[model samples]
Target: MVTSVLAGFAASAVLIVAIGAQNAFVLRQGLRREHVLAVVAICAVSDLVLILAGIGGLGAVVSARPGAVTAIRWIGAAFLVSYAIMAARRAARPSTLNPAERTPTTLGATLITCLALTYLNPHVYLDTVLLLGSIAQQHPHRWLFGIGAAAASLVWFAALGAGAHKLGPLLARPAAWRVLDGVIALVMLGVAVNLATG
Candidate 1:
């Protein structure tokens, strides 16, 4: 059981500690010092829900529905493209990148974006549902695996959101924000393309 849990933790951490839209958004929110707790909570809770669903055998149901997957893929791709455009626009106007100078988004709007980032990414489903679920089933203590995965998400989001402000000093310049948004734009578009193609 311990081994299963550890394996699940390792697998989840590996998959999550990658450069992605969700991570980028969370980091930005953290650095900006805007609703960091809310963002972290949403992400961790969302992951918990998905991990539970996967371990509870919803993964099989999801995998069996090719139509559902296709629909989600299309929706995800569309969302990614829109976000990429927004990021590109942000990059174009480096002046708005300053966290202190920019108007803070409403809580509702921030929550919506957080939810969208958590749900609209096909890769999230692929990793949490298909991959994690399949692997957990291989273990005798599947629920334990889910617990470990959920714990990983909590730790990761907490650290990312709470610790992001430490880098605020470095990203104080418009140039830094410009580069960050530019990279985000490129990554989002690339992910969008992959989703559409797959």
Candidate 2:
């Protein structure tokens, strides 16, 4: 059971380590020092819900549905490609100004954006609830597996937000953002390719 839990944690880490909407938002909040705790809290809780939903037979049902996973694969692939292009463009012609400086900002707006970015993306559900959940189900201690997955999310989100916050000054530079954006583009492109052939 412990091994299963650890394996699930490792699997979750593998998938979540990649750059994506959630990671971007978390890093943004961290750099801004604007409700960074809220952002991580939301992300961790969301992951818990998603991981549980997937492990509790929801994944099997979804996967059993004809073309569901296929549809998600295509949508996720397209989003990843589109996001990669956007990131690369931003990196190439980097913006000196931060977006929060110009955009109308509010807690509600930020929270909604985070939720939309995390949940609205079918890829999230497919990856966490379906793919990872399916793997957990194969383990003897499925509940422990879910717990491990949830633990990974909690730990990762907290660590990421806190670490980025610590590097706030360094990350404030325009050049740093450009580099970050480049990394984001590469991560998205790599994930897209992996999904396409997986």
Candidate 3:
């Protein structure tokens, strides 16, 4: 059981530690000190839902429905492109970081964007659902593996959101925001292209 849990944790961390849209958003929220808890909750919860669904055998259902996945791919690619454009704009025009200007997005907007980022990414389904679910099924304690994966998601998002604040001093400058946004834009765009082609 312990070995299963450890394997799950390692697999989950490997999949999630990459710099993706969700991670980038969480880090930005942590840096801006804007609705960090809400952002973390949405991401962690979304992940938990997917992980549980995968373990519960939804991965098989998803695999059976290739059309659904294809539809999601196209739609997700479009969404990623739009986000890339937005990030590029932000990078081009570094926003002033006055207290009032810090949270340019309302809580509702931020939450929606967070959800979209989490759900619309095909990699999330492939990794958390198909990959993890398939791997969990190999273990005697599949449920324990799922639990461990979920715990890893919670810990990762919490650390990312909370630890980002520690870099607040560095992010105090507009130049830093521009650089960060530029990187985010490139990542989003590259992923979008990958989705569109694949």
Candidate 4:
């Protein structure tokens, strides 16, 4: 039982620790200190729901629908591309990239963007729902595995969102923010292209 839980945690950590859209967004929000708790909560909760759904047999259902996945891919690619363009614009304008100088986004808008970034990424479904879910079934205690996976998600997001502020001193300058935004834009565009082409 303990082994199953550990297995789940390790599997989830491997998938969640990547430099993905979700992670990037979380890091950015954490650095800005905007809705950090809310963002982390939403991400962790969403992962829990999706992981459970997968373990509950939703993965099989989703896997059987190739068309749906394709639709999600295209939609996700479009959203990501749009986001990349916005990031690029921010990077180009170093003044606007500075968190201290920029206007704070509303809670509603932040939440909306968070949700869109989380849900619009087809990789989230593939990794959390399908991949993790399928792996959980291999364990003798599948539910335990789900719990472990959920725990990993919660821990990772919490750490990422909470720990990001430590870099506040480093990102204090507009040049640093511009570089960060540039990296973000590139990451977004890379993911978008992968989704569109893959």
Candidate 5:
């Protein structure tokens, strides 16, 4: 059981630690200190649901539906491309990148974007639902493995969102924000391209 849990945690941490749209957004929210807790909760909860579904064998069902996967891929790519464009615009205009000067987004809007970024990314389904689910089935204590995976998701998101404040001073400058936004735009575009082409 211990080995199973550890395996699950390791697998999940490997996947979640990667820099992606969800992580980037969470970090930004953390830096701004706006709706940080809510964003982290939503991300963690969503991952839990996905991991559960995967462990419950929904991964097989999803895999059987190529058309559904294709549809999600295209939709996710489109959404990501649009978001990348917005980020690029922000990067171009450093004036709007200042957290102090920029107006805080409403909680409702922030949550909605968070959900979209979480769900619309087909990679989330692939990694959490299909890959993790398939891996969990290998353990005698599959449920324990699932629990461990969920725990990892919670820990990762919480740390990312909470720890972002440590870099607040570094990002206080407009130049730093522009660099950050530029990186975000590139990451989003790269992901979008991968989704569309892969």
Candidate 6:
């Protein structure tokens, strides 16, 4: 059972680690040092809610409605492609930030942005609630799996946000941002292509 729970958590983390808008936003905010804790907490909580909902039978309902998932897949693919373009554009003109501006401190604004990024992204529900939840349900003590998955989200968000802060100097460089954004664009484009093809 413990092994199953750990496997569920690992699987959940792998899925969530994709280069989507939310992860991009989190990394960017972390680099900017803007409301890291708030953003992390919001992401963690959102995942918790969605994972629980999925484990509690929402995944089954979603699976029953193939149309909804299909629609979301297309929409998400479009969003990812758009985001990729934006990142590629940014790569061309990376902006260097002042050290003073890179302090993650905005509370309300960060919370709102994190909320919008997490909730508005339909892919979050499809992946976290539907895919992860459904897979977890197959294990005994499904609740344990849910807990482990939720813990993964919390750990990931916190680590990504806080850890990026330590790399402020490197991230502040135009060259570094360009490289990062370029990588982001490629990852997102790959995901989009996979979505369209799959």
User: Considering every candidate listed, which one attains the maximal lDDT?
Assistant: 5
Task: Report, for all candidates in order, the number of backbone clashes.
Answer: 0, 0, 0, 0, 0, 5
Q: Once model 1 is optimally superposed onto the true structure by TM-score, how far is the C-alpha of residue 121 displaced, in angstroms?
A: 1.2
TM-score per candidate, chains pooled: 0.96, 0.74, 0.95, 0.97, 0.97, 0.78
Clashes of 2: 0
Instruction: Mark the regions of model 3 whose C-alpha exceeds 4 Å error after superposition.
Output: 94-103
lDDT by residue for model 6 (111-165), tens: 7656755765667877898888878878888888888899899988888988887
Winner on TM-score between 1 and 6 is 1
Q: Cα deviation of 76 in candidate 2 (Å)?
A: 6.9
Which scores greater on TM-score, model 2 or model 4?
Answer: 4
Q: List the pairs of residues colliding in candidate 2.
A: none
RMSD of each: 1.3, 3.5, 1.5, 1.1, 1.1, 3.3
Q: In model 2, what lDDT does residue 16 have?
A: 92
Query: Which scores greater on lDDT, model 4 or model 5?
Result: 5
CA-lDDT, candidates in order: 0.89, 0.79, 0.88, 0.92, 0.93, 0.79
Task: Tell me the spans in candidate 4 whose CA falls farther than 4 Å from its real position.
Answer: none
For model 3, give the RMSD to the true fold: 1.5
Q: Write the per-residue lDDT of candidate 3 for residues 122-150, one digit (tens) a residue.
A: 98999999999999999999888988898
* Reference-based lDDT, residue 6, model 6: 95
Tens-place lDDT per residue, model 4, 1-198, is 999898999999999999988899999999999999999999999999999999999999989999999999999999999999998998887483467457888899989989999998999999999999999999999999999999999999999999999999999999898888899999999999999998
Displacement of the residue 51 alpha carbon in candidate 3, Å? 1.0
So what's the TM-score on candidate 1? 0.96
For model 6 the local lDDT of residue 60 reads 81
Where model 6 places Cα greater than 4 Å from the true spot, the runs are: 1-8, 17-21, 94-126
**Residue range 1-198, candidate 1, lDDT tens digits:** 899889889989998899888998898898888999999999999998998899898888988998988998899899889999998998888484475469999899999988988898878899998889899999999999989998999999999999998998889998898888899899889889999998
The 10-residue segment of model 3 with minimum total lDDT is 94-103
lDDT, model 5: 0.93
